[model samples]
Target: MIYITGDTHGPKSIGFNSVDGVLHRFNSNNFPEQKNMTKNDYVIILGDFGCIWNVDNESSSEKNVLDWLDDKSFTTLFIDGNHENFDRLYNYPEKQWHNGKVHEIRNSVLHLMRGYVFNIDNKNIFAFGGASSHDIKDGILHPKNDLKLIKRWKHDYTKQFRILNYTYWELELPTKYEMDRGINSLKCNDFDVDFILSHSPSSSTIDILGNNNYKHDILTDYLENIKNTTKYKYWFCGHMHINKKISDKEIILYEQIIRIN
Candidate 1:
């Protein structure tokens, strides 16, 4: 079985801070369907799997949450989103799974790398995860010399501000190499895949959603190109925080867990 859903940022509360990670959606009470699942089954989060978001050392809450997830019967696969701590996520040991590269976060949890195709559960899946943060209207703050920006921002409640290397990472967008790799991978697959998974939707899909607030950059343009060229059955994305079907072949997911195959 294969299931797909949106972001589950982190635990509800890390220490004393309240969060919006929405980890509870996977619990037995909310997603009781997992009771019959096994390691052979897969639960894929589109992106923003923010359990790995702490800028510093892994907190106890994160550890507990990861362990709790590991205890689940099904395996978990995810990709990075803008909210991820790239410093931590990119450092995990790498491994090959289902013929694709991954960051081994745990025995059952894997971070699917960008620009790769994996044959899992008898299905071809093209995975690419990333998105620019749309709410940073105040712009990204630099940590060049001011180390206390986080404290100051928290105290002052700065509007729509994100700190570099701490809250915001330039890697939230795809690199040129990643784009090339994706194009090469698609060429290898003859430009066809059973599924396309990403953190952000194609620019066309954004237009379909009729939302101008979403920014268009290299990543979205790359995705738009893929959307134009690739022969895919369904494209699933997660950044919108809304659950809707943009078209017959594209979906933007959030919160709800849907059994896909």
Candidate 2:
């Protein structure tokens, strides 16, 4: 079976599992619905796995999440969300897995690269993961001088308080190269895919959902192009944090976990 779910920010126990000795949540759940799945089954996370954060100093929470995922019966696959630490994630060696390129975080956990096609269970799957973080406006201010008070202030106090760039926000949108790569890959396969997986929904889907606050970004534009040109049965996304079908083909996921195959 192939299962899919929304964001899980570093496996911090969304729910408990007594069967697994109090270590189940999200894809690692010990619920009856997932009890039948074995190691052969796969669970793909849309984005925001968050296991790679603070790689310089591994926290207990991060370690616990990694250990739990490593012991899981099913393989966990994820894409790069806006909250991920790009430096750490990119350092991992990229290799081929399940007919696609992925960053092997562990033997059981994998990070799916942006703009790639994979052959899973004889189904051609197109995967793209990235989105503009809406919370960039809340980022910390960068200190203009060596003054400690200026640097430590939490609010906009003076003219020197420029919003710190690259602290909380990340460049999570897809690059032009990644966009072209995905398009070319689809062209090679005659633009046919069984499914499309992404972190953010296309602009058209967002419009249909009536979400006007989302910033117009290049990634969303690229996804809109894909929606117009690509041939796929379903497109699943996660960044919206809502459980609803934006259209007949596009679905937004949040807390609910669903089976795709």
Candidate 3:
């Protein structure tokens, strides 16, 4: 069985109402269906799997949340999102799984790399993860190698501008190489896959969703190209932070977990 859902910006002890800490979707009270699931069953988070955050190191608290998820019966697999700490995420050792490259986070936890097609349970699933963050207002500030900026926030700061490699990472968008690799990977697959897991929807999809707040960027444009060419059954995404069926085929998920046939 394969299930899909949205951004869990890390688990939170705050409460069930907080979107930032809404990992309870997998809990027995919320998703009792998982009790019957086995390790072979997969629960895929579209993006913004934020448990991998924390700049300096993998904090003990973060480890506890990850470890808790690992204890679940179903395997946990996530893709990188705009909220992730890319510096720490990319440092994980890379290996191949299900015909695609991945960062094995734990025995049953895996970080699916962008632009790879995996043969999961006899189904071809193309996974691409990334999107420009909508939270940036004043623009992203580059404080490369600046010790003072890392240690403390400015007293008179606007707080609108996200600090690069700190609050925000430019790596949230795919590089030219990553985009090309996606194209090449799809080409090798003959441009057909059972599904696509993405952080951002295609540019046309944004219009369909009536999301005018975000603009078209390199990542969305790239996704637009894929949308036009790829022969995919369903495209599942998470950036919009809403649960809606954009069409019969394209779906944007937030909290709802649905099993895919």
Candidate 4:
């Protein structure tokens, strides 16, 4: 069986599992259905598996998360989300996993790259993950001097001045190259897949959902094109912290977990 869920912000406890320190929501005893799952089964995270943050030198938190995931009954797979530490995630060696290329974070944890299709349990799945963080608003503003001035005005003149910066990166959006790669890969497969998994909903999908808070960008435009052109049974995504079915084919997951296949 293949199960999919929404963003899990690392080891921080959430929902009914609030008392479990440093344990992912998936690791909680509340989800007893997972206990019956075997290694052959898969639990794919929508994105923001923040356990990989500050992975340099392997802190105790990172180790604990890794060990817990590795000990799970099923393999864990995820794609990069806006909150991920790209530097640490990119350091892992690329290898093939379940008919797609991935950065193996552990024996059972895999980071699925953008623009790839995998054959899992006799089903073809297209995975692409990334999104712009709305909280940062207008990412890294221009006029560096003005930012420094603002910092100076907020504090003593003798204090060290700091420049304002964005918490989210521009790399959170897909590049032209990545879009082309995904299109070409789909073309190679005749643009057919059973599932489309992404971190953010397509621009049109967001509009249909009436989520005015999210601004459309080049990445969302590309996904819009894919939505119009691609052939897939279902498109699952996570970013907006809400659970809704935009259409018969599109689903936005936050905390809800469901079996796909």
lDDT of each: 0.86, 0.74, 0.86, 0.79
- Candidate 3 regions exceeding 4 Å error are 13-16, 20-22, 144-159
lDDT of 3 by residue, 12-31 (tens): 73465755453566778888
lDDT of 3 at 185: 94
Clashing residue pairs for model 1: 10-21
Best by lDDT: 1
Off by over 4 Å in 1: 13-22, 144-152, 156-158
Could you report the Cα RMSD, in angstroms, for every candidate shown?
2.5, 4.5, 2.4, 4.7
Question: Which is the winner by lDDT between candidate 1 and candidate 3?
Answer: 1
Please tell me which model should have the higher lDDT, number 3 or number 4: 3
| 1-261 per-residue lDDT for model 4 (tens digits) | 898888887777756744322364675564667878888888888887777766245668788888888898988888888877776777888998777799988998889898889888888998898897765432344345466555544465443332222234456777888778789878877998999999988989877878667878887888898999989999999988788988899999877779999
Query: TM-score for all predictions?
Result: 0.93, 0.85, 0.92, 0.86
Clashes of 2: 0
lDDT of 1 by residue, 1-261 (tens): 999999777767344433245467687887899999999999999999988878887888888888888888999999788889988888999998897899998899889999999998999999999998998887788877655665576666556788888889888988889889989999899999999999988887877788878967888889999989999999999988899988898888988799877
- Model 2 ranges with Cα > 4 A deviation: 13-24, 27-30, 55-57, 138-169
Q: Which ranking of candidates, highest TM-score first?
A: 1, 3, 4, 2
Best by TM-score: 1
